[model samples]
Target: MNSLRLAAGAGPSGRALIELREVWKTYRMGKVEVHALRGVSLAVAEHEFLAVMGPSGSGKSTLMHLMGCLDLPTRGTILFDGADISSLKGSELAEIRGRQIGFVFQTFNLVHTLTALENVELPMIFQGAPRASRRARAVELLERVGLSDRLQHRPNELSGGEQQRVAIARALANDPKIVLCDEPTGNLDSAAGMRVLESLRDLNEEGRTVILVTHDAEAAGYARRRVQMRDGRMVEAAEEALR
Candidate 1:
């Protein structure tokens, strides 16, 4: 609702929309260490649709969490619009993440009792946006995702596809620079999954950077490019995006 300011020319050579330079995520379980990600570097251009594919325990989700700013790398730097995120702490990182990024989880993380409109408005409300604007933006995003008629329906009142749509709408409510989705269509039927993929593709065409993580090949096919990971390392899908 705040007039989505999707970044343009997202890359280092131009102006990286998102950059992870030599990223690593190592977690220690007592004396044993678990390395989820290892020295991964990636750059995504503005509006690029990238599908992150990997088997379970392959660190796709960990990498996604780092990109979403939900977690920090143990030994690397992630830059969002040229800002070094690894240097920020607690409240600072939270503010930037809330203001700049949107996340869509595999599970439809919607309030069961709240109306679709209310659920969609949650992020804007968190961002300290006015109540009226939150309502208006939520409505606009629901419409964008073809859920205009279901605005008054609660999560249980909607189908799985519909609930995911609301979740997607909520992700876009704040007009974030990047929309990060983890297994967005994993819980939907094939037809419903297709519908969701279409919506994501449409959003990407509308100039929003979409970074989706999926293990399904059919799901990843919707993206413009695909990046595969194995043993916590990138498999060299293609050249880094520039400009």
Candidate 2:
């Protein structure tokens, strides 16, 4: 594993942490076929804060899924830390997802029956972390997200922002190198959305590779790099000029 680096800009310079080479993803529905990603090639440097923006059916979500290992590309190669994962089996991919990738979605997917702390602890539990370590780490993560006071609250009892914070904490449980967020603030009001964005920024600052998928320009502005997609293809891409 590479030693992680933290910075205010696009993070420390290193080998490509994520690389996609001519990737394509297609789906078949009845007699029709849908192409979600079309020959996409890209790379994300270690600790980069990348925003993937596209309209509906533009394939940004599919790109995110491919990068996060939730789904494999239909054709082409995907390398994570230089390891080709595009051809991995389901169990192999699941291991990668647990150890190297974290995911956040618009829907706060915290288990309704689990308290915030418990929810944050779930991933570590899956990783076979001991109970004491899991509890301690969960508390630390909740505090990192400014949700220490809401630890015992279930999803139904907390505000949307609080619940999202819990979800973020849960995603960080496995200490993944990459954090994939898909319209993470689409369900929140402006205030809550800002809080979530700030948390993601903080995570990026702390050396996590943050790949955000969203349609909102304001949300995309938080990232140091932006890639625009349309009709299943990348139309434009840019990185912030360093000061």
- Overall lDDT per candidate, in order of appearance: 0.83, 0.86
Candidate 1 C-alpha lDDT tens digits along 79-146: 88788987788898788677778888888889888999999988887789999878988989899888
Residue pairs that clash (backbone atoms under 3 angstroms), model 1: 10-17, 11-16
Candidate 2, residue 227: lDDT: 78
Error of 2 at 77 (Å): 0.8
**Clash counts for the predictions, in order:** 2, 0
TM-score, per-candidate, Cα-based: 0.90, 0.93
Tens digits of per-residue lDDT for model 2, 1-243: 011111112234757888887788999999899999888877888888999999988999899989988888889888988789966889898889998888898998888989999999988887899999999999999998999899999999999888888999999999999899999999999999999999999899999999999999999999988878898887776557541
Compared with the true structure, the alpha-carbon lDDT of candidate 2 equals 0.86
Considering only N, C-alpha and C atoms within 3 Å, which residue pairs clash in candidate 2? Answer: none
Poorest lDDT segment (10 consecutive residues) of candidate 1:
1-10
Candidate 2 TM-score, true structure as reference: 0.93
Off by over 4 Å in 1: 1-14, 238-243
